[model samples]
Target: MNAPLLEVQQVSRSFGDVRALDGVSLTIAENEFFALLGPSGCGKTTLLRSIAGFEHPDGGAVLLGGSDLLALPPNKRPVNLMFQSYALFPHLSVAANIGYGLKREKLPKAEIAQRVDEVLETVGLTAMAKRRPAQLSGGQRQRVALARAIVKRPRLLLLDEPLSALDRKVRAEMQLELKRLQHEVGITFVVVTHDQEEAMSMADRIAVLAGGRVQQVATPLELYRNPANLFVADFIGTSNLLPGPSAGQHLVVRPEDVRLVAPGAGRLDGTVADTQFQGGTSTVAVDVPGQAKPFLVTEHGATEAVRGTPVGLAWQHEVAVGEGLA
Candidate 1:
């Protein structure tokens, strides 16, 4: 990672006895794509708002390039938040929408036009520059919002579920588009999202939050392979969390790590209960004798195993999960 560009230290907040953020601390690198990922009511949005100057944290500090960002108001802060709504003016043209911020600062009309034109090309909306928001598709509108935000050349870009409004196909396309735009703009991105796939696919690193606290912060691959604790194991990706022999301990098993063999050859005896065939992979659920929940196994390509087939379940390795990791 590059040198830290944004520092959030022990930030705390409350909503009349409901502690929203509890001593959250994070260091975001310059030009890195960082995600604040969590389920609803986990305070990720609050954290984003705090950084954007929309919500003042009850405690701790926010620093940008070693300067006090908390002291500045929302408009004065060197950051821009691209809301999920893509709040573009219905009556304004694409060029006008992108140039609005420059107009607010009273920049020269020629300069505004130049910047707007640059970003219009950057977002691939040059041909639609004269079109209104209603005249654009959902993805194009999203680009307009992004272009508007980046045209200001803010130091940081905060996005709150920026792709939530689009359909699945467009959302997937926009995910790559967002990464491209981030790299082209060369700005630090702090995206708050509840979608696990979105965070995993786009973010260079992700801070998984839950219950108003950070569960773990790691790259998507690292987080998936080695979760810090039980909560993280249960949250980041799909895991078959089996209770351990002792209390406060659990086994974290990924479906891919599970293998099936003839009965009595592996550790546990079970029958294939169900199979879900995805394009290139088949997920097999096994009903073990003593286990309350079926163990899920992922098999590449089409699996020949069908329901009622007897098999033994074995693990590639054992990962002992404890409660004290946090």
Candidate 2:
């Protein structure tokens, strides 16, 4: 949204017969927490590696501040990449792990120590500075990896599935922490993740990729509410695709948008085939006639409806997202 900090223009890459990236372009603002979100083999990682200069693209340009980033060697680039693996040296202390990059740079030891101390405090790991990677929990280990990456004060940081190692609860907590650290560190973060919720909850903006191409780029709310096409609608969240009023089009409705009504009272009636209680809310799947998949509707609190109960699906408005947007 602001002046572009990183510009990827018409980038294309191929691994033998497979086109890993095809004409992918994006502009990321400075200090923005951007996410490259897609399923496996979608080329998000390839694009990231291209930006980091680890995997050179077959064509096109990667620019940082309007200069060619692909010109620089990987070690010479002013960017850091944190792999999914923590990559902390088992024998090294947390402080040492964070300071290793500075050590490689041949900076004065005192400066490295001061920076490490400051980062340790910022990441809330000052108390565990002396602990080895083996001694830390999964979350703490992830913090150590992040600390190591950021200690260099790189212009940008690339994370590859940074939360994949943690359990669900810790993953949620670290998502908050990662966003906090991104703001405090003031470094542009570009994370690659297949988990849609992780991207939606943590990123400032998301770029959804499929078949090695970008499907859409927007804020999480925009992507959920106004998906550019069918792939995005199905990928970003669950959707009920009812045949549209016009041919070759469909009306999209989310579970939260659909209302459950008495049999034959609304637009479509069906049998309640399944009910799922997920804590505060419940999901009721109705098997509508002429529909291959069950239509899902959300009900607040708990669902008391039993299987085989007759129900109807209702919604106030019908929208065709766009003509041939798919």
Runs in model 1 lying further than 4 Å from the true structure = 318-326
For 60-157, candidate 2 gives per-residue lDDT tens digits of: 99999899999999999889999999889999999999999999989999999999999999999999999999999999999999999999999999
lDDT, candidate 2, at 183: 98
Q: For each candidate in the order shown, give its overall lDDT on alpha carbons.
A: 0.92, 0.92
Task: State residue 197's C-alpha deviation in candidate 1, in Å.
Answer: 0.7
Clashing pairs in 1: none
lDDT of 1 by residue, 1-326 (tens): 89999999999999999999999999999999999999999999999999999999999999999999999999999999999899999999989999999999999999999999999999999999999999999999999999999999999999999999999999999999999999999999999999999999999999999989988899998888778888888887777767675776777788888888889988788999999999899999999877888899999999989899999887755443332333
Angstrom error at residue 235, model 2: 0.3
For all the candidates, what are their Cα RMSDs to the real structure?
1.7, 1.3
